[model samples]
Target: MHTAEELLKLQPVVMKQLQMIFEKDRVGHAYIFEGGKGTGTEEMMLFFVQLLLCENPKNNVPCGTCRSCQRIKSGNHPNFHQVYPEGQFIKVDAIEKLLNEMSKTGLEAGRKIYVIHSAERLNVKSANTLLKFLEEPEGIVTAIFVTQNINAILPTIRSRCQHIKFREIQRDVMVKTLVDSGITQSMAATVSMMTSDLEEAFSLAKDDAFALSRKTVLKLVEATFKNVHEAMLVVHEDWLPLFKEREQVEMALDLLLFAFRDIVAVKANPEAMCTYPDLVPTWKDAALHTTFNKLSAQLQAILNARKQLQSNMNKTLMMEQLMLNLQEGKSFV
Candidate 1:
């Protein structure tokens, strides 16, 4: 269980609202915490649950030493239930089991709080089953549904819950958090732009494989102007082999876009911040060798390749074609 102070620090406005709700004893039976991944929604939910179950909460803050708090912290709170998706979807059986558990008396003398993560993954049958429970809440129950995609949830389910939107962490804050976590500034800036989630961006920055992939993209860019054959070789040997999955390929393409953007930045404004500040020397060299028009055209080509990738084209062939286009500086338009 996280401290209320920490939650407030992470999201002051949202937490303050929740604190007000708790302070006024206006806590609702159902709430929907909506936010993207890495927005601290899960952590905030856990903290709120602890606040609800804490025996001695002061100013809506959980006393960390209480037995109830200890049980929550240890993940053995009898009244606290959490439901996660099974495979791709939360099936009916899971909801039924949770409803059964919630229907019974609370093990402790307080509210029975159940958090459903990825609530959007509830299948139709399961959502209907949950709707019944929501329609007739029993035994001081509080239901919290957490989801990244609010639209994916049933409208009926959404209607019964109070929606609390969690905003994405600011880019500068995310970068600073990553830097504080020991990631290099250049990598942190790049990864933070790629994802809003502080933890995910930090993880990506520290991933050796992703780091190598970015370097390989830079290498391919360098090879394209000097030696087309070498660029093709990079695609076959390094790019294709390294990015076997579609998602990895998409990330690699994103890195390539970053590299080109850095090249453009080097030519247009040397003082401008770059996603790859550490590679400014290399970017300068590339910028000197290529014209602004060519770089712009190449950026378009990369975007076109991304579109082709989404069309479910053959991955290997699509990448091969993309490499060839980049080597030739061919504009898709």
Candidate 2:
């Protein structure tokens, strides 16, 4: 089986592209594997690289029995180099250094491959350095750029590479994956609405308190609100320096919307099923009605905050106010 087979299923187009690369032996020198997060683009790149380097390649997969496959599997493949953000952005010197590393003679494997997890993180200086390398890859060197936002790459870089668009795994595929991960079929269907990633599902599925808190609000159906402050604290103090505040806020709203959706559902029909079925009993009709206006206002507020963030607003204050409004009893706040 291909790498990431367990977590994601590819569309026919993507599979066809894989087969073409294997058969033609004309793997492009540069490629942009673009898709949403958890859609398995990164895993697909690694699998494809393995297929290219596999000595005893089979059915478009690298046969682990062979030495080449063994080396790649063991992370000892001399020809494979992956570069990612050591901090936040890929610096010019870092990429320059990676390019220099690629130029070296390798102990094994015919093709030298470099996988950049977030190609968008390349700052101007680093991007310019990469442009020079892409202008000329002298040998069987392949660079796979994985991105959720393909437009972030320069036009010069975009025009030079083969662009492969990847979509989300279908509902059925997501459900089956969740089931295989020991989730009941009903829960799988419920959580798949948010996302199908196993790691996410597992956490959400297990957190009954999180679900109830979300029902206290209305848009997203199963998102829990219990750990908002805690989660935000970690993101602010620990991850803010690493990931953009825009991303963290988006995640926060995702949780809020999901929770509020359950609140709406419970308000309208108490008997109806909710994403957080386990959290249903905690819901109160009075609370739901009182919170309705606040929920709508917060939706626009989060959107406005997101806009201000683009204009360089203070993220900590934006989040602090947003969370405070969301946490209070809908009427009193």
Best by TM-score: 1
Which one is best on lDDT? 1
Q: Write the per-residue lDDT of candidate 1 for residues 1-333, one digit (tens) a residue.
A: 345655675677789988888899999989999998878899999888888889899877888779998998999999999999999999899999999888776366668899888999988889998887887877788999999988888898888999999998888777776787688888887887688877788788989987898788878877776776888888888888888888988988998898899999999988767888788898888888888888888899899989888888898888778777787788654
Q: For residues 236-284, write the lDDT of model 2, one tens digit per residue.
A: 5543443355754465456544455666667767776555555566555
TM per candidate comes to 0.79, 0.64
Clashing pairs in 2: 210-224, 214-259, 217-260, 218-260, 218-261, 219-260, 219-261, 220-257, 220-258
In model 1, how large is the Cα lDDT of residue 307? 89
| Cα error of candidate 2 at position 100, Å | 1.8
